[model samples]
Target: MGCIASKPPIDFSADVNFEHFKLLRSVGRGAFGKVCIVLKRDTKKLYAMKYMNKEKCLQKRAIRNVFNERKILESLQHQFIVNLWFAFQDEEDLFFVVDLMLGGDLRYHAQRSGAFSEDRIRLYTAELMMALVYIHDRNIIHRDIKPDNILMDENGHVHLADFNVAASIRKGSLLYARAGTKPYMAPEILNKSGYNQSADWWSLGVCMYELLRGKHPFRGGTTEEMLEMIQSAPIKYPTTWSEPCISFLSGLLERDVTKRMTITSENVQEVLKHPFLASLDYDKLINKELVPSFVPDKDKVNCDAMYELEEMMLEDNPLHKKKQRLQKTTMSKQEQAKRETIGAELQRIAEKFTVYDRSKVKSTPDVALDTNIDDDEITSASPRPQRASGLAVFSNEHDSSHMSEDENALRGDSDSRRVRSQSTDPDPLELPTRLVTPVVDDGSSTSSPIQA
Candidate 1:
């Protein structure tokens, strides 16, 4: 197998006809291509347009994958998932025009703040769970459900984005090839065994674990080691973790996919009745009533900081370039070696930081600056501030001194910064705070898990 380059060539001519859309700034860049912020000339609506190189895509044989993603997205309609406005292809590049998610992503937010409140986590998790149910109902499996792919709109509505790895499900059939972030993949996927929509539930469990813990449940040296951990019952809940939350996660992370949470399965009902989601109003969430925890005044990631991290990693680690798999292209031997090196290093960092007990921490940050705890109060900040629903370290005083060259070089940290920003800012659209209705626990329950 060829090692795909995780990083794309930085230099590319911008001669493609964008029609009436004017390019603003580059929002995201991956192995596949780059996503640029643009405004439609006529409608004046902002959009994030993804540009995929045709020649490169053909080399990777992802033409079908790209077309399938577009078809799947065009046919479905859901508030939780990101909206795909349109897809077009020139001779050299494929363009995907999607709704511009101003909040960036949950992964970026989490890294900047370290962690989020249980309440905020619950809000996002419930929203995503509902999305999974909807997508599965349509016979689509969103293989990738990590924070980066989960986006937030100006209205604070959560939208699941990035369906490049998504696939359709046939009636009573199982999927063969397994793909997704290794840490987020279920045991059945890692073992080369077949799976279906249940695989998404397992990834959801990993996402929930990451939301509260700020790290993956399983970290290992090799892919095999990570697989081993998932295959066993070594998932340890933090000492401060609530009983109900643990019960819910345990069911989702079950090794047996048949026993995992499914929309139509008893486990879904069991999860809904758990105390973790006890605050969610299922009707409101399903109806798009729940608002996102954070929104940004401006639609932009901290690219300067992120680019600095990438450069520092390239210089310090030498293996930084290959730390993450590039979905756009095939991997090369050198890149694969680098990926292994970085993945191992990242596992060490995850283990070290996983010690923070979320239950003991305050839901919001105790800042030295005078900021109101009320969700409606907006302080007189130069850039304009919003309600702080979760913890974010993006204070006015956050200078180069607060971050070390080595610390800023890490990849996951940059990713988590995106998530933290979602809950820290006021929406650009001046949206109202849509309250999340807590789940009504009927008092009917299931068996508990073995104490960790």
Candidate 2:
């Protein structure tokens, strides 16, 4: 038997191991293992514990990949990438304790909103570019970049997670794996001889296309159909997309791998210099000004007092009588249920029409449909499904809240209320407009650093 070894705690030293961690619920599941919400008993810290059965993983020869992932997680630290706290092994399983992304994945949001706004896409793309720049600079190719892998935080900032297929590069290492999401894959990656970091950029471009237009650029029914379409997919610009967005993504989605726009590459710099992100200042962007364009619904964010103020205003409005009348006339329970059932049926039918290349991009794994696990296994640890009912998780707090809420909301107890009357209606528009970075003065001369 392979004995399970546990290590001392990093910060709060209370001897804990796989068995010691409280298993709240299964957040996700797959072929290899399952991800469950676990609580560190002594510290009371919550984490998504990914459990991979060593025997099952070794059978697939994916242990090397798991090892590589652990190595990569240990070496990197960046705002746009998910943080891996620790890796440990037990007799039967390899456990990865990771930061929880309560906000869920981008694919969930994309499905809900029909399509993300151009502004929203810009913000997400910018974060992805920064993460890629950091990843590539360290000679690691993520090999997977898609909406499903991009996890959101309470603040709406995107973190690139899922390094299961990531590879570290050397001078002559072979990169094989006709892997990655089919529609998001670069043509070169599909060939699978080997691909450099440029593949991530091409994928990013595809992600942007989908974010702005609500569908992938290259799509079809079967995997073969998708590969064929991807090979012949045009760089057609949608009329609905903004001019700046179209131009920037066109450069990114170039068929030539060598010419693909990367974050640090000159072509990428040229794309960022475009008018679409003209107001974007990288230094400020990182520090939080020019924040993410798409904030989660305010109801999803915890703005305890701010919401109360809004309610008070609504109560005082002259149209309060009309509002009450409208509420009363709204669909009754039976009618509402009927409408929901019909809507769900229509959505299911529509999904059949919206096909994509299924080059078999990985998800948590094929989950057990039965058993105690729910579809949203990732949230099994939660007390309940937190309905989106607060301020944007990513919005700057006007009033002080000691601890941030869950992925979709923050909870705080404070008596003060900020004036809610002066802001824009949609929560996205109500974000603070201050710039995080100072503008560089063109006339001011500075000394260029001398090379030693």
Off by over 4 Å in 1: 1-17, 265-271, 291-305, 308-452
Q: Candidate 1's residue-wise lDDT over 1-452, tens digit each? A: 99887735323133223454554444565435556566655456677777776545434434444555666666566678776665655423567788777665766555555556677777787888777777777767877677667777766667888776677766577766555555666787767577788899888888778777877677555545655787885888997878877887888889887777666533555567678887777777778776656554343342222332332233221111222322337767986675565444333322321212122334423211111122122111122211122211122122122112233212223222201111121224332221111112232334221110
What is the alpha-carbon lDDT for the whole of candidate 1? 0.56
Q: Per-prediction TM-score, please?
A: 0.63, 0.60
TM-score, structure 2 vs. true = 0.60
- Off-target runs (Cα >4 Å) in candidate 2 are 1-16, 171-176, 265-271, 297-452
Error of 2 at 327 (Å): 57
Q: Rate the local accuracy (lDDT) of all candidates.
A: 0.56, 0.54
What 10-residue stretch in candidate 1 is worst by lDDT?
A: 417-426
Per-residue CA lDDT of model 2 for 101-120, tens digit only, reads: 65556765665556777878
Cα lDDT, model 2, residue 69: 62
Can you give the lDDT of residue 256 in candidate 2? 82
